[model samples]
Target: MTTEANSKSEEGHDPFFDHVPERRGTHSLKWDKYQDPYVLPFWVADMDFRSPPEVIEAVKQAGAFGNFGYGKPSPKLVDTVIQRMQERYDWTIEPSWIVWLPGMVCAFNLALRTHGQPGDEVLSAVPVYPPFLTAPANFEQKLVKVPLILDGERWTLDFDALEEAVTARCKTLLFCHPHNPVGTVFTREELQRLADFCLRHDILVCSDEIHCEMILDEDSKHYPLASINPEIADRTITLMAPSKTFNLPGFGCSFAIISNSELRARYKKARAGIVPDPPAMGLTLAEVVYLHGEPWRKRLMNYLRSNRELAYERLNEMPGLQAFRNAATYLTWIDARKLEVENPCRFFEKHGVGLSDGSDFGTPGYLRLNLGCTRSLLEEGLDRMEAAVNSL
Candidate 1:
């Protein structure tokens, strides 16, 4: 079915524009935690919208069978993944390379333990996802951060700075593609340069491409780090999942594509006795979404592009706010430096709008805003932000 078929109209049926019931009272991280009556949460990465009809239906069909034993990923699940890779990125992936995991965070920890030694350095570009900073330390490795350069409002990697940060002690590089917080989708040339650098330093690369399917620009294509070159693929572990794409994160299913057999063996060894198989329902829905939800996803991207436009236009009109236009992901990175507030998070909190603190992502004086909400909800948040900024 087309995404338009899924959408609801103002007077009739427009699922995309409608307000759906949020599972808040049942331990929802986005809604239940924010208790203040006036506070509007634009903080978390998850969307406020409901899952697509196709995904929900798939899960329901699986529930009908009532066989929830110790889960094993079905051959259908592997086929779905292979089909998606071939269709979306023009990259073919062998089923043997897929390593099932309960979540991407677990995979990150496993990669760190497998690739690096104690006191060895793990390099990543910041401001990045918080786990990228903490995961290395959790494995008894040092975290080396290289800041992304601000070209006007755009965030791009500083290659020279990154190369300088990589030393003999650095063993692995963790990369977030279609990056979190500041969303910058790396170009092919950029990925090639990164691969060259990693090859020169003999550093293994772990690429988190969970946001690869959520592209805002029709012209922009996500290049898997492993697919860039044979050398890089041999040294890379590429992680992806339907959780982010189909809003199935609660389902607890993510997989890593390991091209090199030796590297895969080491990774599996580190994860032994630790990582368990993904849930049966997760595998079920993952297969269903890959086969039936492509049209819905295309429409979701279109809707998200509209949301991004609305946010950018509205945010720029505010006196002291500057939002970086993102090419992918539903998150917008806004610079609030002009507000003159020493603590921007505290400043926004006082105004009843909770935003992710830029400091948390290693970039001060900026805030990340999740724009994946109904237009009315977004407008309410934007209004609160304007009041807060004006009061300052």
Candidate 2:
């Protein structure tokens, strides 16, 4: 791994994050989604910032090798993951517990396949990631959407709604930690309550924790759901990746941690010839970032904190708009139900700001904005959104 220089706070201010690379015409899904060149796309979760410089340099070194072949996670990478879990989350995980995959979407889909039978049910909170909404159907299972109740500024899980929705056929609970749009970093108490609920229902949990490292609030801490206790650990499958944290989603690498031998075997069986290993380059990048990307990651969190504050303050200022003050992730969830327009997303899109439609996340009359961009770009998007809302 390449060594990083000491990152000074004063020096870290502008040069690194302020520069926005031109991504258009490069087949970037975030940039190329809109045919209109003027629209600023913030629909996807990926950041506008380039990945850590150390990671980029590693990529260059790997490319220089000139041979791309079938690859698996190196022992170093697996050991790094094990150490990270133990050190960061205080969760001790064995090497045998790891199962590598090309992407998180595939991992969760495989979770549904392994744990749920056809005609079974999968439960998840509403306004979740779009994949959680669709993965159940892909496995011929019913998706039970439980609404998350708002407690002042934060969104919390509703056990009452969950209890009402649980049924005999409920085989799996699809969970998102540092949850996608709402960005609620689960507290220990919340995790305990959720774990108890799952234990009582015997529901296998597939916790998507891809955003585990992106906590912006100093008071908030991310705990792996399985790390709550051994009982819950036996019943939970925690999915994570460096892709989201390091802006390497295009590299396509992710993993699942299943402590239960039975579940691990089942997951492997489900992924058997159908799923491919993560790309060789992706594994290389993952190892490099995990080992040497901390300084860069720290600087990133600092930058995102300001962006989150600016976004939350701006969106809430707009009439008929309310932005959730999220504890983690670079996503701001907005309530646009009170807007006079027929469609909130199109309204902003027309004004040159493209946002993820809340309807797609199973909640209509709301919008999710990506605050993972430079201040200038984010300000431009917010300005468009404000003008659009004012016209109403």
Per-residue lDDT of model 2, residues 1-392, tens digit only: 12333334342244577777998888999999998999999899989888888887878887798888888899999999999999998999999999989999999999999988999999999899998999999989999999998988899999899999999999999999989899999899999999999999999999999999999999999999999999999999999999989999999999999999999999999999999999998998999999989988888898888888888888889999999988999999999999999998998898999999999999999899998888889889988888887877
For model 1, the superposed segments whose C-alpha errors exceed 4 Å read 1-14
Regions of model 2 farther than 4 Å from truth: 1-13
Error of 2 at 218 (Å): 0.6
Per-residue lDDT for 150 in model 2? Answer: 95
lDDT of each: 0.85, 0.91
Root-mean-square deviation of each candidate, in angstroms?
2.1, 1.9
Model 1 TM-score on a 0 to 1 scale: 0.95
